[model samples]
Target: MITYDPHKWLDHFFDIRGSLVKEISGRVLICVFWSAGVVYFDKNYHDVNISSLLHTLVGLALSMLLVFRTNASYDRYWEGRKLWGGIVNETRNLVRQATVHLSGERDLVVHLAQLNVDFAAACMYHLRGAKIAGMLESQHPPLTIATQMTFALQEARRRGAITDIILASMDQNVQLLIDYLGGCERIRKTPLPFAYVVHLRRALVVYCFSLPFALVDTYGWATVLDTLVISYVFFGIEEIGVEIEGPFGLDENDLPLEDICTTIRHNLFALVELEHSEPDKMPEGL
Candidate 1:
């Protein structure tokens, strides 16, 4: 995941530079060839009739639309990135509060803190469409409800004091966990609208196909190179937009949620002054 900061664009672009260049180059070549062929055919058969004025207008519109498309897609990508940034901060905040509030209640405190870490990892895997087996190792649905209630009962018994104030504090912290889970679900379930994706895709394809028609009349065989060059830029932007729309996935350019989850785990563990231990080996069929 690109860190959520303004100064690191170079690092982010460098990370995905090769893939970007490759996609753009392919599109440029395609446009160039199509443009050149159309020009050649027009000259040979006297069939081309596109006016210079009309060509210029079409080119202008195409350029504007491409720019707009690039901006819109980037906006969506950045929004998703920002949402993940919120998740990271919220996770840290939750741990900090839990540690401070639950002090002196060693077992209850440690377990709750650990669960926060686990939940963070679970959310990350779920968002990326990765298998959930690892995150769900200790508990399963239906059973988890009962198990969670039982765990709460234990924590209630283990509270620092039996006063109402302590109970209220515990309740508040527990509710924070619920809120975090809800936030993750919101991001994972809600995607950019289908119509927007469809429209963008259609626009890109139309521009690609029309490039040959637009350039063929003037450049003839030379239009091939021109089309290819322009197509490279346009296609590269379109492809990047597609990759970024759902930024949670495992793609190279997608947010690195796993790394973020790892950070949460380390932070929570450190706060409790717990000696770090390697996670237990997962079971054979787990």
Candidate 2:
């Protein structure tokens, strides 16, 4: 996602990198030209007056629908972030426990830590509908990594490296990884209802096109400016909702999954290095 200082109002006002201006500029221009045409016809040809009161009622309803649409999309975006946050926390917990509890077995601890990093990377790729380089043969890379981790934990428990209780606790963390994966998949697969989106878009177009009729009577030639500003607002709102609804792609406004995965990898490797370098500080048992 694009990051900026929220306190910098002047910088943001002039910034267009992550803004919807490019996406909605064409629609806004169409509305402006349409308004200019309506003004020209009214001035030179005949009186073309539309009921301003009727347009006012329609505008109120459209505004409410737009608000709902934006809210729903934001909810999905926030939920995706929360689910990834859970993944980050659980991965750290599992690695920390492994580092302390299996400090003597440095090789085993390193293997487990690598698996956690792989699982996180796999999840990032899976959500974006892509595949990791070596794991392209695997249908579900995250699940495959999760299964490997489970088996490794089981082997550790069988060989007396860890007790049944410790194994169970670590296993729970692995299960939570799968749960987070499921949540991400659900959000990616399910979208807003088709009919609702279609109707909302249609209403936006109709409202924007009819706005000229409502404003030309009073604003005259300046109706072009008014329509341009109003249409830009409406179209910009809708474009933002569309861009953030999935929250997994590489859009400027989408979640930064690459950065998040890199963080997980760095954290896990750091924990492993700490365990190896300071084995004397680690406790004997869990």
Candidate 3:
């Protein structure tokens, strides 16, 4: 994942609002062309009417609403990103602490490392809308979700070959995992208010539909081009906001959680191995 400092440049490039000017400019050109057509058909239509006023007002309102939507969506998107950043830090901290405190202790170190991997995978699955298999039990169970989950994790700690200090670190790691999970749940459960979404969508549709009528009298044939460009710009931004709000999944643009998890695994393993083994060159695969 992106481990670099969260820069506004990233926001400027990725943020939806940044393209509004371009969208508006292109549509204005089309509107002008269409207005010329209408003038050619009937010069009297060149005079602005109430419909023209309404069109201007609607365009202005749509622009403002698009800005507001982008702001709100980015807020949610950034918050989710920040939360994941915390998870990465905490995960690394847990492993580092375990390695330091449990020096010369291999058994517990292995167990803790495995737990770290499992936790990251589980969280990924949960966020991607997958049912956390092995998390629930009501079907029929000698060991229910409650008994199995708590017991398995605790038993891993109790029986693992780590030193006392390492065990303590593992406990802290578990708590951190719980907190991260709760944060993820909060993002998942709480969405943009339904009323707000409904209002914004209705406004967008009305704006797009009314645009043609308002511009047609003045721009004629150019109205079609103007309408398509303006409509796409507004819709494009709304689509991005919708995508970012979830911030999880295998979408090409979604946060790269899998890559982050793999990097953590590689780093932790490399650190542990370096501490014990001498560096050696390896031959190409057999």
lDDT of each: 0.61, 0.90, 0.63
Q: Model 1 lDDT vs. the true structure?
A: 0.61
Candidate No. with top lDDT: 2
User: Please, what are the lDDT tens digits per residue for candidate 3 over residues 166-233?
Assistant: 55555665566667666866887788889988898888766765566577666666666776677767
Model 1: residue 52 alpha-carbon error in angstroms: 4.4
- Alpha carbon deviation, residue 54, candidate 2 (Å): 1.2
lDDT (Cα, tens digit) per residue for candidate 1, span 239-271? 776667666777767777778778877877776
lDDT, candidate 1, at 115: 68
The total of clashing pairs for model 3 equals 4
TM-score of every model?
Answer: 0.72, 0.95, 0.71
- Model 3 scores a TM of 0.71
Per-residue lDDT of 250 in model 3: 68
Error of 3 at 78 (Å): 1.8
Off by over 4 Å in 2: 279-286
For model 3 the local lDDT of residue 215 reads: 70
RMSD of each candidate?
Answer: 7.7, 2.8, 7.4
Write down the worst ten-residue block by lDDT for model 3.
140-149
Error of 3 at 63 (Å): 2.1
Cα error, residue 160 of model 2, in Å, equals 0.8
Record all residue pairs in model 3 with backbone atoms less than 3 Å apart, i.e. clashing. 34-219, 34-222, 35-218, 35-219
